[model samples]
Target: MSDIEIIKAKRAGFCFGVKRAVNITFKAAKKGKGVFTLGPLIHNPQVIEKLCKEGVCPTENTEDRNIQTLIIRTHGIPLELYQTFLKKDFKVIDATCPFVKKAQQYAKLLCDEGYQVIILGDEKHPEVKSLMSYAGKDAIILDSNQELQKIKNKKRVGVVVQTTQPTNLLQEFIGKLVSRVSELKVFNTICNSTALRLKETKEIARRVDLMIVAGGKNSANTTQLATLCNASSVKTYHIETSSEIKKEWIKDVARVGITAGASTPEWIISEIESRIRDIGGNGDNGYPHESGRN
Candidate 1:
């Protein structure tokens, strides 16, 4: 049997917010309600597909009039759409993560206080878009320190961040804005789960020769995890499922580290582990050790 050791990151599965959102959606589906989500509940496709089969339809927009029950994604939605849903009298259930909701509230607080609100994240991201809406249409979305040049000598600036954004980026952005803006209010709204995942994955990357990050390809957090690992000294591969684990990638790899995005389900992690064991060129007992977490 080939000798292989696998290390699984403890934080490598669904975070609290995603678990809460999935539970809420499944519960609604079991009640036989016409359950619907404004967008995919979470980034993981497998989870979304499973929910779709359970009759939780994902709508591109809020135009559907017959939707009996609507669930807001964990990423939250625009304030305007939320009001529209209320006006239409649709039974709305908000699944927005507490951290995301806090950011939204912070944005609104800044706007009401007449501060120049600046969102530190990708403008196209739904979370940023929603947060910006709360801040006001005039609020600026700043993606980088370079973008800060666009700010025209504001008196007071209030800043909020996307929940999934890297904490270092936020600190750096604030550092630059500190000198430019006379009065600055910086709110660090990154989720705890996200911070933990990054820390754990980086630790694992240092210990293992090969690192495999598991989750949906389009998932921003997942992509970030993979990017972090890839930039490190270890060889890292980002895969959505076990089937993508190539024999060549694992060839001659004695130690492998596995980390999944927050949205990944437990079953997917297990499948990836099992596949790694099989692809390590040993069916019997290649997996000598697995530590860190489930």
Candidate 2:
């Protein structure tokens, strides 16, 4: 067999939202005061650990009266929580990604205009829950096409999605609702960064012998990328760090592809590439410098 080669997605890792969130958190930490994120600033543990070293930490609840500065993550919190912080006089640094902010705005707008807002995402995800609060008590969360059947009246339905959700899932939910609803308005709120990553990952997966999805396990976008890759019927592995890589997995593979979620850092990707090269005896494959096209 020929020597192993590595192919990587150009758009993978640290999209605008994650970058902004990390930057804001680090800046706050630099002030050398107590800084608390309403949740983990982003999904990558390595990044979180780095932030912890800088004096930024995640609190389980947002009602931390002890912390003077509250940093919202890229996935914006519920409107009620934002109000609560304001009421408590906590100095708030909103690190919510612009893409997620847009989704919240669109959901709120639809609900205010008397349309029944339908969120297409995981009902329990922090971002989706936050968006639901913006949509008011009447909003519905549709996780699958079957859930759409339960929606009543179906007229004046407004559609929005979690930024990390696959575009096809959102489209499938909307397509199902369009037939049942008399009036449907879709905001297409899925982040372009996410869409691009998914597209590029899927493309790379098609040409590789195995796909390694690098990111924190808890990261929604990272898991979604792995799911997309596995759907291609290729061997796929999701790893949080380079140490997790197993030599046995790549024994027979001659070509491997690497991709990361929006929250993944460039260093982690580089580390994974290095490990793969050492184990598989392949050159760098000129990732990040290459066009990233398969």
Winner by lDDT: 1
Q: Write the per-residue lDDT of candidate 1 for residues 1-294, one digit (tens) a residue.
A: 344689999999899988999999999999876789888888889999999999998997667776889999888988988888887756889999888999999999989988888999898988898998899756999888889888864788889988887788988888888988789988888877888899999999999989999999989889999999988878988888898988878876778999999899999999988888777733334434445421
Q: What TM-score do all the candidates reach, one by one?
A: 0.89, 0.86
* RMSD in Å for all candidates: 3.9, 5.2
With a 3 Å backbone cut-off (N, CA, C), the pairs that clash in candidate 2 are none
TM-score of 2: 0.86
Worst 10 residues of 2 by lDDT: 281-290
Tens-place lDDT digits, model 2, residues 1-294: 225689988987899888888888888888758788876888889998988888888887656666878898887888887887887756889998898899999999999988988898888888898899999777888888888776775778888888777778877777777889899888989877878888899999999999999999988789999999999999999999989987777765678999999899999999998888767533233222223432
